[model samples]
Target: QGTLKYSFNAKDKSAEKTYQCEVDRPDPTDFSINCVGERTKLAIDIDRNLGKSKVYIDLNRFAGERFGFEAVRDPQTKQLD
Candidate 1:
């Protein structure tokens, strides 16, 4: 796990939030992705054939200047297509 640290301030109020980010160790069994440039598409092929699962893209995960990502999924399958 890693620590996420940041600070915030306002004219009349100030706040700080510190959270823990658990590093995701790659698991080839279920989830996989195809990435090109700044975009990433995730596909999960589960054993149960659950049709297709959808994943939401969080912009904050690619907050740094050196990297970025956006989610593109099919409307029918709701999986990255």
Candidate 2:
């Protein structure tokens, strides 16, 4: 468990916030981490066996956009796509 700090600036305004984070490894090949704040949340997952990873973010009222990323590796070719 840990804490994450973030700062943002827009035009003439600036803000700072802190988030609490947790990490877990439920399986030998899998790992997960999550962080949450007053109005934001973030999550990440990784699977070593399958060579897959993902990330998710939500910035409730702080930003107008929410985004995520997903990636997979081709086992035979050893290439990520």
Candidate 3:
């Protein structure tokens, strides 16, 4: 478990908020984390072998978006990027 915090401005006023968080790792190669509070939510998925990853965030009061990434290791050099 953890905490998620953020600050934002609306109409020239700044405010900060915090959320309770939880993380889960069902396997050694893959895992996920989630944080939620009020009307906001944040989630993430990761692969240990440099395969794929995803992230999503929503703050209810604003726009939300999701991102995806994929990576492969070089067989000869054993490097990932």
Candidate 4:
């Protein structure tokens, strides 16, 4: 298992807040990934040469008020995986 720590600053009309969270990496087949953010968004990366491999993210149901993903990568090389 792998863990990732993220932090971001978010502001609305009234105020601003800094948020942080630690999220565990999801399974390779589980393309539906999410980030906890006030204004949430999804980020997916895929290696076309790696067969049908792809990444999917859905950030509509996050817990935190602000969040983001730094990066996501498989343990093996791009060619191997």
Clashes of each: 0, 0, 0, 1
TM-score result, candidate 4: 0.23
Clashing pairs in 2: none
User: What overall lDDT, based on C-alpha atoms, would model 4 receive against the true structure?
Assistant: 0.40
Model 2 scores worst on lDDT over the 10 consecutive residues at 7-16
The stretch of ten residues in a row with the least summed lDDT in candidate 4 is 16-25
Find the candidate with the highest TM-score and give its number.
2
Whose lDDT is greatest here? 2
TM-score for each predicted model, relative to the true structure: 0.28, 0.69, 0.55, 0.23
lDDT of 1 by residue, 1-81 (tens): 545444556433346554444434355434433322223222223321333444333334465324333345565666764
Q: For residues 1-34, what per-residue lDDT tens digits would candidate 2 score against the true structure?
A: 9998777754433487778999999899999999
TM-score of 2: 0.69
lDDT of model number 3: 0.73
lDDT of each: 0.40, 0.88, 0.73, 0.40
Least accurate 10 contiguous residues by lDDT in model 3: 64-73
TM-score of 1: 0.28
Candidate 1 vs 2: which has more TM-score? 2
Compute the lDDT of residue 55 as modeled in candidate 2: 96
